[model samples]
Target: MDYKYIEQLLERYWACETSLQEEQILRTFFQQQEVPEHLMAYKAIFDVQQEQAEATLGEEFDERILEMIEGDPVKAIPLRGGLRRRSFLRPLYQAAGLVALILTIGIAAQHSFDEEGQSQHTQFAQTDSLERPADEFVTVPETQEAAVTVEQDSINLTR
Candidate 1:
């Protein structure tokens, strides 16, 4: 028999241009016992397709799968009342901690400022005690006349 049609179909099949009906025809042609010697190499391919087409899952397939899945039941974790309460108050606890931290920092900064202000006040008091009155007499050196000058007048002029 002339195999020009089958050869043409095989070419179209390899090029992926065959219709489903054309492919079925090729499978049927290759399934025959007397495939030509030139086309014998492709016969095994069609035989495997026919075998796979005839294959069927057993009746117990679904039952076996369901048994395997149900064999080990997943345990559910029960939520406790204390865990729920803690989760709900988590944000409140965080806010309270933040407030306590801020208050601690504020109190520390206030104490530091108070200590610095007290030290500055003490320094100012000490300097004020050591300062001489501007009205007191200041002696001139012997290079000039021995004059007991009023220091307040010179201090006022400089100011």
Candidate 2:
């Protein structure tokens, strides 16, 4: 048989125009008892291609990849160097502290308001008790005046 057709297919194969069937045809034709002298140069290339096409990556490949990875040095984290503490309850602690600070401020403000009102009321009562018109809304009650008079009498007695 003339090797003309095989030579044309090999030419197309090199030019990247041959179909898969044509490539298989060329591979089959080359494996004959004797290849044409000129085509002999490509025998080893085609035989290697055929062998590689039948090959698959297997457990040996996985083992080799793992061994290469395991051979590298492991990275270490420093105990006190740039690491921050992580806690699930840190937000709760912050919120509790914020609440305590706010409550303290609120209680302080309330106390200041109460003290101001009490001081104002005591000043008003002292002024009213000293002397006031009979028709005023806050004329001194007789009972409160009597208590003051009693305290003064006690002081006079002690003297």
lDDT of 2 by residue, 1-159 (tens): 687888888889999999999998988876675887888889878877788888888999989777766654232322343222323444544444444334333433443455654334334333434443232222324324433443444344346
lDDT of each: 0.56, 0.56
**Which candidate tops TM-score?**
1
lDDT of 1: 0.56
lDDT of 2: 0.56
What's the TM-score of each model vs. the native? Answer: 0.40, 0.35
